[model samples]
Target chain A: MTRKAFITESDVRALAADLIAAGTRVVAPGRVGTPLGERIEYRVANKVDEILLGQDEPARSLKDFFLPPTDVILAWQEKKDQVELTPVSSTFAPQVIIGAKPCDAAALEIVDKVMDWDYHDELWFGRRAATTIITLACEGGDRSCFCTAVGLEPSGTRGSDVLLTPAAGGYSAEILTDKGEKLVAAHAVRFGADKGADEARAFAEKGRKRVDANLGLKPAEVRKWLAGHFDDAFWKSIALACHGCGACASVCPTCHCFDIVDECEGLGCGVRRRNWDTCQTAKFTMHGSGHNPRADQSSRMRQRVMHKFCIYPERFGEILCTGCGRCARVCPGGMDILEVVSKVNEMACGGAK
Target chain B: MAETKILAFVCNWCSYGGADNAGGMRLKYPADVRLVRVMCSGRIDPVFIIKAFERGADGVIVSGCHPGDCHYTAGNYHARRRFAVFRELMIFMGIDPRRVTFSWVSASEGGKWRDVVSETVERVRALGPFEGYRGLTGRQHG
Candidate 1:
């Protein structure tokens, strides 16, 4: 038998307090005072008023919580015979990330393959392992959402421990995994049996249909077309307007390219840092001896497209794009990925010869 | 005319072999093209390309295997895709995309190797020295 419960609006605050009292760090969206009124911010849940569960999505991504813009990876001191490398603390407290959308959770899974394969990244994995994600199905889809195109439903539970669907004046919580079950059991009294799970499911289906209508391409077909058209002129034509500002790459849920650098001062003490990098930048692939293989805009654009649709799937059996539509929204030139993928497919069918 | 400095990135499998073939035939191409061999064309990072221009290279040429003829099977394909995008980005930054060239050169194509070097040298000569990046970085031209 599966356990299901309804968490009413009034009980949300108490439930948040319970999670905090249980020694788990709870992160949820809140409003922070900025120069221009209050801006949505992710904050540690100390009070129930700090949690915002009904919003479409945060203005910024949840990636900053795991991979900060700048982190001290190493600290070293010069010694007589050898360099003394100070070990950074690996201790991380378990955390609960509430109100993540299904597409955001799915994006983490896509990132996990790149961060885990060949070289296991402890920084990213440690944070991921310590976090249990609770995803909320969008009652109404936003224009910037297209999760359905990338093999995700608005209500999909691909990367969540628990999935919550909106119900009449309450939320129907489904324990998707053992971890979620344990979490619910810790605060069982606050939740009651939800007999309206069937109705919530119907509401979620209606939301998924709106998402599907916005996504213009099926991911599998896009991947197939990209695999074959390695030398098409379509890349140059579409990518000509790209400024290489890296806004699209930075906002994208699955763009995970990074660069490692060692920094030092006059004292010979230094730290090695890994920072987010984008192929959209011209300096991403230059060699030490003054040679560059990827020295063109069309080539760089093709790389971004192929990395998302072709190479990633061939390596991980999953596409790197979650179709969060953040890239399209953030690109200065309005470089819509859906339009690019559509053109790729059209060319594959001999329409753009 | 002063000799133009050109950086040639030769992929380990094909273009490097093509360079060797040029040497074996004693085919006199411009000595201006300096060769830097890499494991695969795909492994060539775009940062190095920008660095070459910063260091006062008149031009840069990236030669790999004919699309599907890479020793690593699909290395050139990856290179092609990457370079196409990087080239566009450079152009948007006001760097002439012609300063960077991508061509499919096979190991047996010694004549093609000569042609690539001569053509790149002539083109860079017409463009004069690469002075745009030097002004921004405040570095002396070579």
Candidate 2:
């Protein structure tokens, strides 16, 4: 049977301390100060007070826990004119993520389709298997958010092992997957039978309404319009001020493009590493022979939109974006993706020929 | 093509030799061009030209030997077909086709090489520097 329980704010903290005491790494949304000032980041938490759960989405997504920004795949050594490659281990240690945003969690399930499409990414799945994600119903996003338009709500539990909704004194813990059940059972005293129904119900409603107030686009129409208009002049105007700094990609929940390079430390040894990359930049498609297919920012911008709205859905049966709105908030050029989608919606209506 | 910065992709056996001949004969070519030699014109991927423009090149030229005269027979033919599609696509995306010029110069035609370079330089100079995608870095003005 599925397990449902009530975890008070103090109970959640105790659970975190208990997990850490048992030598399991606990990850949560915590405040981090950057040059841009204080923003929440998904980081390791040593104490419960450090965590800021059920707030606005973290500046970064949960993808980093599964597919890190940079990872070493293999190492090589040239000994006596014979080169040998040593493979890196795919297995990782146990960890638990607390207070995940719904959009961030859903992005994992969406990207999982591609990561496992052609070839199984062993490292990606390895971390996934080793980690259990506990997601909190979101704190609500701003005008830039459009999660409801993409068929997701603030309470989405698509990828979380455990779903937590704020209640009277704490949260209503809905044990979702097998890992979540085992966790609650192993630490049975940390949770009590579900008794926070009224507060949790009201809180979930408020979150849903907050996100629903944002813009909604018909994904099917957006995809159809994008499929036929690769040469549209609308694309030229959409990216007029695009800085191509790729800050949007850097914060995107599902933008998972990466580049592999061989870094040599010395004449005898070297390592092959993969680093996150973005199509927003020209180097993403540049050829060593001095040619680039997606040459300018306009062309690159078109690819970004196409991949999210058309190519990915056609290939994977799902839209690429989760409507987290972090891209709009982070863009230096003021390129708002929601505004572009609104234009695409107007064009789809057959008025902008 | 631009008087400010013009880039050229020349085929090793022919266009490069044509440029060499012009220099050997003391022909005066425009000083705007910088040449990168590949084994054959077919080796020039469209990305090279895109990279050039992304780096602020105002004009670019891809020169090779006459189609049937390529050292590696049929290489220039492939480049011709590729550029035909790419050129139109660039125009559709608002990049002026005149900014990117394609020509065939034989090794014996040193004068033709000089003329192509001079003409490309003059045309691209008139059009001015490309600012279409410079906002991407925002540092282009710096």
Top of the candidates by TM-score: 2
Interface RMSD of each: 16.1, 15.6
Task: Summarize candidate 2's per-residue lDDT along A1-353 as a digit string, tens digits.
Answer: 45678898888888888998888889999999889899889998887788776576788888888777877788899999899998888888888998888898899989989999989998888887888888898756788888888888887778888889887788898888998888888888989889776776777778778877877677889899999999989889988899888988888999999999886643577678877999998888999997999888889999999999899999999889989999999888888999998789878875676
Tens-place lDDT digits, model 1, residues B1-142? 6788889888988888888898899999778888999988998888878878866687999998998798898988888898989998998988898888788788999889988988888888888888666445321110
Q: Candidate 2 - CAPRI tier?
A: incorrect
- The best candidate in terms of lDDT: 2
TM-score, candidate 1, first chain: 0.92
lDDT of 1 at B72: 90
Note the chain A TM-score of all models in turn. 0.92, 0.96
Question: Candidate 1 — what's its lDDT?
Answer: 0.79
